[model samples]
Target: MRTRALLTPLVLAAVTTAGLTVAAPPALAAGPDISVTNTKAHLDQLQSIANANGGNRSTGRPGYKASVDWVKAKLDAAGYTTTVQSFSTSSGTSYNLVADLPGGDASSVVMFGAHLDSVSVGPGINDNGSGSAGILETALAYAASGQTPRNHVRFGFWGAEELGLLGSKYYVGQLTTAQRSAIRSYQNFDMIASPNVGYFVYDDNAVGNGVRDDFTAYYDSKGLPWEYIDVQGRSDRAAFRSSGMATGGIFSGAETIKTSAQASKWGGVAGKAFDACYHRACDTNTNLDLVALDRNVDTIGYMVWRYAAKDYGTTTPPTGSNLLANPGFESGAVSWTGTSGPITSGAGRPAHSGTWKLWLGGNGASATESEQQTVTIPSTAATAQLSFWGRFDTAETGSTVYDTLKVQVVVAGVTTTLATYGNVGADTTWVQRSFDLSAYRGKSVTVKLVATEDSSAQTSFVIDDTALTTT
Candidate 1:
């Protein structure tokens, strides 16, 4: 039912890349710090598009197609290869805008997507404009960065999601087994900037849990709290998951009231629905929570970089000789400096392979933490490889502010960034990340993991099974 007028509308509102160059083995680059202001600009454009084509961007409507065109144009201008996939919907012919960033592993693709259509009632800015605009802005950021990732990143602005996931289902149906298997992970964002927001993470599956953990880590680092909301079959993710694809995402909330406990933790009024305008004509630009929108958009970039930026080898590493001491934190931060305090170790949380893991930030904990250990290389070794399993969650409040995780190589007095991870969105599952240390083979070097949390909205960062070996 259209409920805009029946609920209170919160006052909060408002809220990329390219390049050439083949550099040294890609050091883990920081995901672009997304701009809330730029996100607001996209919302304004969507609002304008809706205002001109009819009062709504609904399926089979002029506004819906126009929204697709506008998004496609931006992607094209930014150098993303774009395509419009047509599908038949009850309302009529609808289109989905699919944009691909070239130069990643085609066999293993990572998708960041959102539904682009609104219900027929209003502008639907909050119900979906929040998500569509957020994903669109993140895509543009990727183009601007020009960083070649390890997995192909695909962006989908789906149509008819409001009409029962018609567009997404169609798109998924068109994929062959090979195509489906190529999708390593799919992340969806819907209604992320709800007015009276609650930070909710989608807990769909094991992979979804990893995604949830990433967001959990981010909120933890920022000193924010979150709750798990099972949204199976609730959004476009339903379609992808139904097709056997791994998926995860974030939602600010909708219609669900903020409990007193939630209010105490998140600092919002109790008894108020996260969004007062769910599927109503008043879900306009003014109906959003700027803070929520900004953080989620930044998270989209983080997840893209962490998951899409690397190739998860098809097989797990064989357990053998590992050189780093206290590799899994099972013995607690021993052999590492600056890590004896603040670091957490224990059971309960899922681990990559052991009963313990090192947590850089705990749930709802905030601080800048680091752990370093100097490892002496055997003069006889001509090359070395560094490997570790890590998972994280970082939040971006704006273009210049966000949590971060960096793995560094220090020799003498100089520090070289080996890799970085942040805005993990929801990565909770353990994934292995490796680096070649052949460059420092002959010298004693300090291998360090540093985590930095912003002043607000922090999450967690975890690592396990560290190893350095000559191969």
Candidate 2:
């Protein structure tokens, strides 16, 4: 959670007005609302913990350890193997707790965290007690659901946040390079129930685009007004984002006063601070707005449930550069694989460069067509890349992913889809796309571009001037 000094409002525009390109996803069954009363009860317990120890669950303090133990005991009973990571801080020793749910692909993890320790002021309930309780309940609910996940689920409760994001930074710093890469997304929640609340979503990095879209879609479904928060170095997300993982999360306003316009939109007091008790002693359970708390918790639960099963392809998107023969189809089917029909010029869809671009799936029928080439990267090569100019003109509309062009890589007979471009963004001009293929060095693999069309609308993926090169 943020202290007043660190609460800088980077960008406060509504989600719809934030100039984000939201990819349409199918409606998510957000599941039933997980006991808001129970969530609130957790807030009360944290409050009591603070009241008993020192009126604050500050890092290196007895209340903080007690808080961690209380939460760990609950998770242990729920069948989670938890880890408590200890690190040194100005306060002497601080800790971070991580609990990984059993089952699911550990290779790709979906993580969420909230700062558990609070300022040494009052009981710090709304400052972060709200976020901690919400995430705790979500974790418990997922454990009890009996639903096996596709992606691994992990939850974290960090110590020493008010002392400048120390615990989260330590947790992230301890991860190995491969472990860092394995985290596909990280969601951080802090100050979620400010008395005067305004909904906010994290937005940064193109990699976070898909996750950002999911949050906005959830809010839109609930008729909730959400804005984008830059987050920068304000919270735990900055730690993971700096380590090269895509991150997204929810935040209610803190420290900043609610403007008349914001108050008009979200129904809060116009001229008052979002959390009049940001890091002060008055930040107790009474500092919360249950209505906003309920909505944000449900949204977090919705994302956790959906992403646990999200398919991130069989392998990381193939990354490298110029190893394929007839890379652009300029020489037709002589050095490539797939339907020869896509190599021709006159069947429609202008080429990105030469007249021989690969044109797939303009048949307006339920069909699939592809173009691929086998390439080998030397083990000694330090860098490789795959680049191409392409565009899709689609007859389909809305966010429904009707027609798609799957960019895939095949290694050891396993095809991993690097990306799936859908029918939403149609264009009259070509766009350039590239991926790092260096990860496939020392192996020969088939890099394929496949397009599939629905029975109704026609979508054409026109490709030209492709190159996979090593340097």
Candidate 3:
């Protein structure tokens, strides 16, 4: 990781708050608890260390190792047994600092983690340094408050995170099968607090539970505008999610630009992305908007206090497999009897070309080889109807014309031309074409496609979304 020098003075003067100065001690404002406020100062200390060393804290680097030492020392001082899980990686030798707060039932554990590695390009202030500092603050606060969470609470500082989650995957992979089962939930904070002005609560639950709604209600009750995002395999949460553990976190912004519409809804400036430094060297101490960052830290503290601090609810197994959640047609087969034309090679035809075109030998270069699949779709009698949508691409030879398309349907073992279509010229836009099979309502309709016109033409038809809809 390389840090770029920002010759320009950070725009810290623009964010100065009344009676609240970064240069002064951080005790004038309200905090979760007195200890929690000190935790914020803890972040300030880390930020100072990272900034002093080339404006970054990256894995295998001196700044990164210093950050690890600081966190491990903090955990050791907190009366917890600490372990340094070191592993070799392409980036270099790195380590994940883990500390256990064992509970009455050590069998069940709750994990709270944030990647300690900053981006190689920048100080990674907003990307993950923000997240790491917040976790430190929370852990210190948890220690000072003497809040004994029921489940064993584990804190982690994952290394080499900038190298595509290598540290987290290693930690998860090393766990024995029994230890893996003991994990009840994983709450990871990758970029909890950014100088970015907007708030987001990620939804990582496999099933869309009322998590987002609950999170919204919690923040809205505090007069805050909170945005919702799905944990779509963006960070360390993916590791826990793959192992069937409930996962979720909060993020300000990484590198993704927020549109004007989003900025309008949220009060951040438009055109500028949520976080400007994202993964750049400019992410120094002054790069953050502390007002926004502190608020997000409190937000995360609130969520953890409510969910991981104590057990208010239990997680249930999913009712159904994700397979049925979004079932899709993989492949199928169709057959048609027409003018027996020689199967052409080199050129493929679209499956939507109809039967008459097959008789004319102008459908396509290749003829149907055999019947592959016959699907039976069931629909409500009230609004049952069969419809098909397909796309056609003209032959590539740049010929004056290409193949024509048609379709055939089988009802009660009787074959007939259900729909007829003319030549579909090559066009880039999707042509929305439909056919009414209302006559076959509530019945199994077997369908086949043809692409035979001037057997010499090599046009092809691509078919999609063949369905029986109740409309």
Candidate 4:
């Protein structure tokens, strides 16, 4: 969980035609490395905007509104539902930008937030531009990924945070009880790119929920040392934590003196403040640790992807004569035997007919994921056909067969790969794939879809609208 974007990649190519240049959309990264270049580009925008508006985007200031407008425009263009929530402050009126991915369970929302406002004294690049730009790029990348999530994903850019977290407090104060409860998890990020950074995950023990575990695990996986920091009643997290929503996030230390041991572990000055600039005029683009900025933004992207497909292992009872339980995944992950997070009702990709589908692979790493169900065909049936609609999207090209989706059959625990689909011809159209099930009549068999991908690039396999019919 972390914060801030809108899109138009930094290095996108264009075909110029007499001052009418059309820029091509940049190819999206599979996950995590959702383009550090894009994140930095967003920070560049924030820096320039601050420069044009009195060196700061403090609450109720012209630069703050410009920041909100800029981020909203990007999200709007990328298809997120954007809203500018205005609140009154002592100075004047300030704004918060909220953006949501279109689909996912409305009852449970996973949110990533960062304060967009800086202090009146400086540009606040590392103080928060790191976080703001990080989240914005993450949002834009999610829009480009086209994988719908299981839980609703929202991004918030708050206002007046430097003024004692007033913006987030005000925003939460306005939510109805039901609306507040709906935001099941909130992750706050502030000052993530200190010049001398210390990776710290929020730990209130009672309010972090399990998000801290995920955050710690991610750090461990990367071999990055991290420590738990108490952020309760501090920063924007206080607003959500006090509202009964579970809260957690990471903070690169701000204004704290670096200890000798911490320096040895994380590498930087031995005793200087983690972020020497903190909120001063020197807190410009030059004050950032680009390495920390890239890594944290990548982590932000990873977390968003994780929560988007998070499944709580609950499902609805099978209905109708389809012979498959929760075939479309609309009722969560009912009757599914493989892969914990693939059955998604996300709106990023079109389902065959409904709001849910079985998604596998596209993690951008060497991975395999699948979904399966077991059923017995009646012996008396004259004909039995197993069919489903499937669609595919990929970052791999040119027929080398980097990723593959195998439709398999398991009879008496003997697995057989029935058909193998690859990235070369896997289009975004919903095409029917069928296999005769007459051979398995009077016997129980497991129908499975297994997707495998190499370490680079991603290929997503989406399946839905299944039926097993006999007459």
Candidate 5:
């Protein structure tokens, strides 16, 4: 996940010149001592296997299969229930190695994953052997050290990732709708570090900017220079994010070069892709900068330990005020008013009654012209009270249908049916729907409303004064 830059000719030129001048140097600061004797040992094993097979751990290759077995044996020895989820593509059969260290909320999980397959080009030593080695080391360290993470921590070693995040995509797709909802987050280590050096962090675009701030805080605190890069599906993190999970990872530069500007910010030679070997055959064990690799291992390991373990504290419940309040000029909320629009209908779908025209809000929320808008309440609240105003027109034909509506709170996509109201048939007046989301307590919710439909479907409905009050 860690890497940066767009390769313009100019950028390349700058990197080449700067790289020649700035030799890959190791970080002076000492990383916490994790017994990586095993990590180093595993690296050697992977190297030997790679060297034995024409220096390649290509997918479907014997060396790759051997690598999978090696990891499986280690997990088994560590008392993890190892399972191989296999799939096939045009290339060949690939495997995703999953092992569970059941703990904490069995339902809520924290996943730690890395890709085990290397590029067909060479032993793929630095390309991923490094990541595989690091993860193997970390997992074994956790087992040997006798430290238990509070949350159910799952480990995965993906295959065919170099081919485009295939393993992760397949894994995420296999989860039942219910299983997907229980995941807390995913921490990925694609390339824990590079012997080539430089530093950067992977950014998941779906997530808010808070992750970046968290990284800055950590790097700045350690006086370590780091850069940020957009995450490409080149790794497993991208796949997790695609499934709506939050993701982040550390990297020590790759084939992409650091710019003068980046170097100034992160203190690396401007214009060099953090690591020179990248995917090349030269990406051997010797190419790695132990200093950079060591620091990254410690930095990421600690972060995983802290967040995945949930050591910070329990999340607080939303307040009664926050729950009862509605958004408006009073609560600093923005209003989205719908104008008259054509009504469409279709057969019943899972989440919708019929076909509909979806209007996405400026904030990226979907809404209908006749239905109420959706609001996402912040998680910081202790107890929240949500209130909104809805004006409905129940003027119908043969049936005496009520001008009713439904309000719901969706926490992490799991909807909580809150309240349903009938505005009294034929009533074209605004009714207040006050719902106490206190049951959600510590959870954040995306508020949703569906106005009841009648034969006399109105052209449009107006909603205003939506507020979520926090105690």
Candidate 6:
């Protein structure tokens, strides 16, 4: 659940097609609408995973690993590259899964992510399976259309988020300085299908406001009204903001009781919490409001395509050559090795722009998932940059702590930690992060993304859109 904050000033902004809202490129006319039926199908799978494993996909549990495997398999079949990253905490080890699509401007990246792990007490279908399924369906729809975009897109399925924010933090800490700068924006969806739902948008910062506005515009376009809610640091967005990255996302409601006004607008029980089954044993697939899930998932698809295909008039288009081969995982994880756990490909979630991405962790307990690629830097190059987009969702329960994701440079036998992440608490959005590799100019170095879990009951981490450039 997200921590609550005072609502900021509500400013409803209209979506304009003129100057503010950029039109989609010729290559990507109006993107395909996501299928609500398909999104609900994902939720069904998650529920099945939980039922078959332990009645709950809690971190460090078999159900969690099963959930990750199910999602990865779907993404792989859809032509996306995926990776599984591992992290540890007092509860135990956990994982994060990241998927990337091939072929888009790597410089300007967009991301969307959701947490796949649930609390120990329940299936957590409405609490987060709603979001996970919504994003998953959107990714699959993108793959089915086979459309190209102007910006890169990535998707992340986080682990151990209910415990704290371990997985997402680890992912953020592992980015190279150059990678962080390439990300254009990150959007997150947490509890979008609560039984007694409300259309609440995160309105805390400029980035958040923009996301809220986009959602509001979507609702307005459908003749629906939305209210603003400030979740200051309760969820995954907190991890992005901690690293000075722009972040935004949506949530329905958690344990907070709805008011009569909200009931009038959204039509649910006025005094009940948006999700009375939140974190409880009854948070099964049956706990969701399908109408809410359908609408939010559609909105998710619309925003993802809008950001990925439209020219936001920001950074210049990428030019110079990339030093690393298969930088975007478009080539099916070529020139890379899984040093520990498995790294694969899939079309499971929104990517920076292509049809694939490399995913790490989400396997099981006490896992050490990692992948590395060796790149040679030209001697004449004065500066080198390593960039990528990443998203993570982690958790901590009780006294358990410690889950990590690391980006490191290995030259000869020595490994230097370029970035390190642990216990980010919550961040459900993709952020572009980068690290300077100038010191490795004129040499061959192994760039690695490592996910480590301390014990069990931890979370997950994800990464994509990798690029190494020297000029």
lDDT of each: 0.74, 0.80, 0.57, 0.78, 0.59, 0.73
Instruction: Tell me the TM-score of each prediction against the true structure.
Output: 0.61, 0.65, 0.57, 0.61, 0.59, 0.66
lDDT (Cα, 0-100) at 69 in candidate 1: 90
Q: Write the per-residue lDDT of candidate 5 for residues 272-358, one digit (tens) a residue.
A: 677677767776767666666676666656655655556424543234432222133221111211222212222221112122322
Write one digit per residue (lDDT tens) for candidate 4, span 1-471. Answer: 112222221121111223454344333334567687888888889999999999988887899999999998999888776656677888789988878775565545789999998888888888788889989999999999878576768899998887778888877886655467567688888888888988888875687668877777677667677777775455688888887788889888876688777787789998898888887899888888889988898888878998888774432222224555456665555445455568877776778876888888878899999777665566666767888898999998797999999998887768988899988887788899888888887766678889999998888888998877676
Return model 5's CA RMSD, one decimal: 15.2
Rank by lDDT, highest first: 2, 4, 1, 6, 5, 3
Instruction: For model 2, give the 10-residue run with minimal summed lDDT.
Output: 316-325
Off by over 4 Å in 6: 2-31, 314-471
In model 6, the Cα lDDT at residue 112 comes to 91
- Which residues of candidate 3, in runs, are more than 4 Å off? 1-40, 207-214, 312-471
Please list the Cα RMSD from the true structure of every candidate, rounded to 1 decimal place: 21.3, 20.0, 21.9, 17.7, 15.2, 14.9
Residues 84-197 of candidate 3 have per-residue lDDT tens digits of 777897868999887765332243467778888887666666667777777777776666676746555677789887777878888888665545665676767766555546
Task: List the candidate 4 regions with Cα displacement exceeding 4 Å.
Answer: 1-31, 313-471
Model 1 score (lDDT): 0.74
Clashing pairs in model 4?
3-135, 4-135, 4-136, 5-136, 6-74, 148-346
**CA error at residue 405 for candidate 5, angstroms:** 51
For candidate 6, the clash count comes to: 85
lDDT of 2: 0.80
Model 4 lDDT on a 0 to 1 scale? 0.78
Model 1, runs deviating above 4 Å: 1-31, 206-208, 314-471
Per-residue CA lDDT of model 6 for 146-168, tens digit only, reads 67766767888888788776777
Off by over 4 Å in 5: 1-32, 208-214, 261-270, 311-471
Clashes of each: 31, 13, 24, 6, 39, 85
